[model samples]
Target: MRHRRGLVRLWDYAKPSWRRLTLALLCMGVEAVCVPLMIWTAKELLPPILQSGQSQALRRLDLVALAVLALGLLKGLASYGHYYLGNYVGQRVIQGLRGDLFWHLLRLSPRFFEETRSGKLISHLTNDVAVLQQVLSENIAQVLVTPLMALGTVVLMFLLSWRLTLLVLLGAPLLAWVLQQMGRKMRRVTERMQQRLADLTSLFQEVVLGIRIVQCFNAEERERQRFGAENERTFAAIMKGHQLQALMTPTIEWIGLTGMLLLLWFGGREVILAQRMGAEDLIALLGSVQVLITQMRKFGRLHLILQQGRAAGQRILEVLDLPPEIPQKPNAIALPDIQGHIQFDHVSFQYSSGEMVLHDISFEVRPGEVVAIAGPSGAGKTTLANLIPRLYDVTSGSVRVEGYDVRDWDLASLRSHIGIVPQEVLLFTGTVRENIAYGQPEASDEEVEWAARMAYAHEFIVRLPQGYQTWVGERGAKLSRGQCQRIAIARALLRNPRILILDEATSALDSESETLVQKALERLMEGRTTLIIAHRLSSIRHAHRILILDQGRIVEEGSHEELLGRGGLYSKLYELQSLQARGEGLE
Candidate 1:
């Protein structure tokens, strides 16, 4: 039943290309008709050449040969059209499906990505889709054409000699039962194989993204062993699928051949011994039987392809079926221009697993206020900042922006006015200029340069080989950490967002790099409602107010000087950091 649904979904994907599919089916029909005609002409040509009169036999042979040649030509032309159009339709369907999958993935909430492996998603996009493409490109044509060819041949055989045709068809039920059982097993095996492949891909991606950590710890051999184990599992699953396919093909062929042997024995006896059937008729019956057997074998192979495709299609559909965790409502309105007044009113939040991350978090940041959120690690500082942009809707209470609940605003419009610069800045594989203008693609060259200048990135960018056009390697590997951060800031600056969330943006840099980035960040925060999630106490000293959190609730809210005077959790944390900075031990 699941496989049936998958096939229906696949057909829906194919609906847009009905014209090409219709033309391909017509070509297949023409080709199917020509096969029987060619076989009949051969049978007719045989009897004429065997006649005693040479001139009459030669004349008949010429006409039959011409008829056979014309049929072959027409069949070849139709075959070409069938193959070309079928593949064209297949490519179109896969392209649309792949594109839709990607678009859907992009619209999914960040939590979805946090829970799902990048490798598994990448496998769905590339490997699984490629498997489905094989069904569309090649197997689909065989699926349609082979059955038609087989049916036409069966009809011709029955017309010539029903008894022989009936004898050959006695194996049909057995062959079908074998196909059904093997195909079920093949689907199971193929699904497992795809899962193993996804695991292998996930492991490889995890290792590559963390190669530095692996090399630093000298765990290359350990990683290799882990990868080898996964590869072996994938190999085993693939070989199991291959074994089923190998066993099925010959099992089906043997059944078909057994039926053919029975037909030959019975029909040959009737022709030679009883003289109940003519030689020409027996010959044509044999020809038709060969075509039928070939079609049956093709059907067996097509079944395997269909099983594999169904497995792949199921995987792809699983992703498409997921509703976006943060879906926008039909009545959601565009976020109007605001002065960046963000308020969290009795807000509490939790993940999908029901582990509460924030509790009764009430805060109000007036327009252009720089509110620093200081906390120890895992204190929900970042989570609190995330609520402002509606990355995750609150579990119970409301988060409002400019007097409107964020849930009432369009997601895109809400996020467009916000900018984030995380501690781990990620730059795409593109030019430095492109990275800066990523948020605002239509930014003029001068605007990009101006943002770069504001972020203090213009000097280093201009020093690169191609200036702004210099290609930053993956994740900005070619640039320094400080350079990447500044570029990220420049990206935010270019968008000129009304609100900014700096989640430890300067936490990962050395003193020299941090100094430069901090200066750039100060320029970025001017006249914007900013939420700075920072662990370093020194960075928030100049903020208008600091909200210190512990265990998912605000423990202290005051200016840095006021918090220092209070001697609460904030003071203790500040004292610890101060002692560490001064190279002193805490007693």
Candidate 2:
């Protein structure tokens, strides 16, 4: 029952083409009937052509040739029907499964991507899905057809001579044992190979992404050596599977040979000594045995192929079966455009490991309020910003917008109304206009340029080779860091989200770039309910109110002057920065 579940789950992916599958099976059934007929034709014609000298022998031989030819034609047509239709179903299924896997991956929590490698996920979608396509299209046909061939051949053997059939049947249990053991070995090796392949993929992605680092460090040789190691592991795994598959064929063959020897010895005595059957009957029975062996060979080969696919299927299924970390409730309603009133009431959050990052934090930002959150490194500043968008749900307490818990809001609607420009800028490979209007792809060209102008990006953009139409390379590589940041801001501006988050946006910029970006940020913050996670204390001194977080708690909260006057952690940090700026800093 459990095994059926696994197979049924895979079949469910293909169920969309149930009609095609049914038609394919009907075609396979027609093809299967041809196998025993061909054997019977050979049996009927052999004696007349080889031994009998009767005048009608030639006619009988000719008739058998025509019958065989007709059967072959029927088999060919039926084979094509099943093979093509089966493949069609297989293609549709894997395509759907791949789409589903990608869609699910995109919907998973941000933590999933942090913990998982891009290369491994790519492997699952590409290599693993390909394996499933091959197995289902090719190997699955054999799985369905071989058994029918075997059963038909066995029935013919019984009709020809029940005693010899019994001998063959007696060997079935032993052959089954050999096959079962080989299947286990094949599955183990295939699974290990898949794991190694995923590792190799990860190494490839990492090396490509960090090629500049490798070259800058003059570590090309080291990187090559690392790649060689991963390549060798993958090779070792492939060879292991190849060796197992090689052994399986011969192992099954040797068992078949044993069965054949037993049948030949026992069945030969009946024909030669007792005259119980004609030489023609013996030939027919032997032909049936040969057909049975061929079917068994097909079965064994199919088993080996399926084991490899099964390993891949397991990987794909692992991802598909994962429950989304944050699932929308059945009764969840779409959140309307909010007034940007943000509140955190005793909010606390932990990662998947359950190590608390925010604890018992309570705060509120009125609509259009400019509140800055300042803290030392690792103070959960960004995490607090993240909770506002439901990137990670609060571990305890509630984060609310407009007096309603974020969980109550529709995820898409809520995120759509909130704009986030993280410290790290992300841009796709597209024109400036496209990137700027990504949040709302339907925005007009005038609107895009307006947003760019608001972000202070239009001034520099018009200087580019193609102005707003210039193609930015992958992740906006063709643009400067400051340019990318401005583009991201323009995207957020086009979104026109009620709530905005700026996470150390200018920290990575030069003085010239920072001045431009800071001014742009000030413009962006004019009327929005903003949460500023500040890295440079100087940047947020003019913020209406500041909240200082430390070790997951709100250590201080007040206007910049008020906090500085209190002479606490904020005051000390401010003083240190002030000294550092004036060249009177402590070493």
Candidate 3:
């Protein structure tokens, strides 16, 4: 039942390319026909043409030779058409699938990514997709051509000599057994190989992404060993499949040869002893036997390829089957121009595992209010702010923006009205202007410049070798952390969001960079409803209200000065920061 569904889904994807598939199939059919004709013509016509008197033989030979040449020409043209059009369809379908998969990724909630590894997702897009291409380009033709070739050859062999053909047919059961075993083994091996590939990819992604940490900790050798282990696993898995593929060809060859040896014995007896068969008849039967052997071998090989492709298709299906966790409510209205009166009303939340991370957290930021949430790590401060943007839905109760339950708003428009500058600023490998204007791609150059200036990112951008046009290497690795942070700010600034989220945005920068970012934040925050999650006590001093969270609950709430006077979680956090600063001579 499952297998049927998978094949049905695959056919749906192929249906759009039916015209190309039809053309390729036609070419495959032509090639299949040509192979047996060429062999049969050579076996029957060549000897007869020779036996004729020289003058008559010359005339027959010319026609026979031309006919054979024409078959070869047709075969070559059809083979070329089969391969080229097959690739066109395969590539086109793969392009569409990749696009759909990527868009699906965009639709998936953060929860999906939280559980799925980056490398595995990438493997789905690359190695997995490549296997499907093989299925389309090579396996499809093999499916049509191999069976037809085998059936045709068998029919031709029977016409030449049924008794010898029956001897060949005896090996069919063993040949079928071989293919079945190899397929089962190859299926398991291919799945393992793909998994190993994802592991290697994940390891490489992690090691490359955290190269600084690896180098700083002198863990290069450790990482190399880890990657080497994964590489060896992949190599072993591949060789296992290769061994099965290699074994299939020869085993089937030996089976077919057993049939040939029997034919050689019996057919020779008829020619020399019984005098019942002509040499032409024996030669043609032998030629058909060889053609049958070749096509049977092709069947074994194509079976393994198809099995490998089947494994890949299952992997792709796994992702395609996942429904977007944060699918919006049907008929949800667009969030009207947000007045930014954000409220979290007795909201509780948990991850997919249902372990509560936020417990009945309630808070309100009136329009233009700058509310700061201060908490220890893992205290759910970030999780609380993420709710307003509906990155994840509340487990109970409601989060409202502009007095409407967040679920009521259109997802796109809701997100459009809010901007978040997360702690770890991410920048694309593109120009400064491009990164700054990413949230508002249609923003003009002047607007981009204005936003960059507001974020204090303009100065560094201009000093770049190519100014706004400078290419920021992958994830802005070419720039300093402070520079990346500023660009993230500029990106959010350009959106001119109604509500702003500062998720420890300045927490990682040096004092100088933080000062510049904070100044930019102050200017950008004017009259905007803001939720600030800050670890540093100093950064949130100017916030209209401060909520101190601890272990998923708001333990204290007041302005920074009032919280300090209360001597609670907020004060304890402030004391820790002050002591650490004095110890480091920052005070």
Best by lDDT: 1
Residue 362, candidate 3: how far off, in angstroms? 1.4
Regions more than 4 Å wrong, model 3: 1-4, 49-53, 182-252, 475-477, 582-587
**Candidate-wise lDDT, in order:** 0.88, 0.86, 0.85
Model 3 residue 146 lDDT?
88
Tens digit of lDDT per residue, candidate 1, span 1-587?
A: 44447767777878988999999999999999999988988888877866858888888999999999999999999999999999998998898899999999988998999898776788789878998999989789989999999999988988888877777777666777777787778878977997888788778778888999999999999999999998998999999999988997788768767777887889989999989888888889888888887787678779878867877889999999888888778988785587898898999999887899999989999999999999889999888888888888899899998878999998888888899998788888989988899889999999999999999999999999899999886754388889999999999999999999999998888878899999999999999999988999888889999999988999899998899899998899988888887874433
Model 1 ranges off by over 4 Å? 1-12, 179-201, 212-258, 475-477, 584-587
Q: How many backbone clashes does candidate 2 have?
A: 0
Estimate, for each residue in 60-161, the C-alpha lDDT of model 2 and write its tens digit: 889989999999999999999999998888888788788889999989898888778776677778888998889988678879999998988888888888
Better of 1 and 2 by lDDT: 1
TM-score result, candidate 1 = 0.93
Candidate RMSDs in Å, in order, are: 3.0, 3.4, 2.7
Instruction: Give each model a TM-score.
Output: 0.93, 0.89, 0.93
**For model 2, the run of ten residues with the poorest summed lDDT:** 1-10
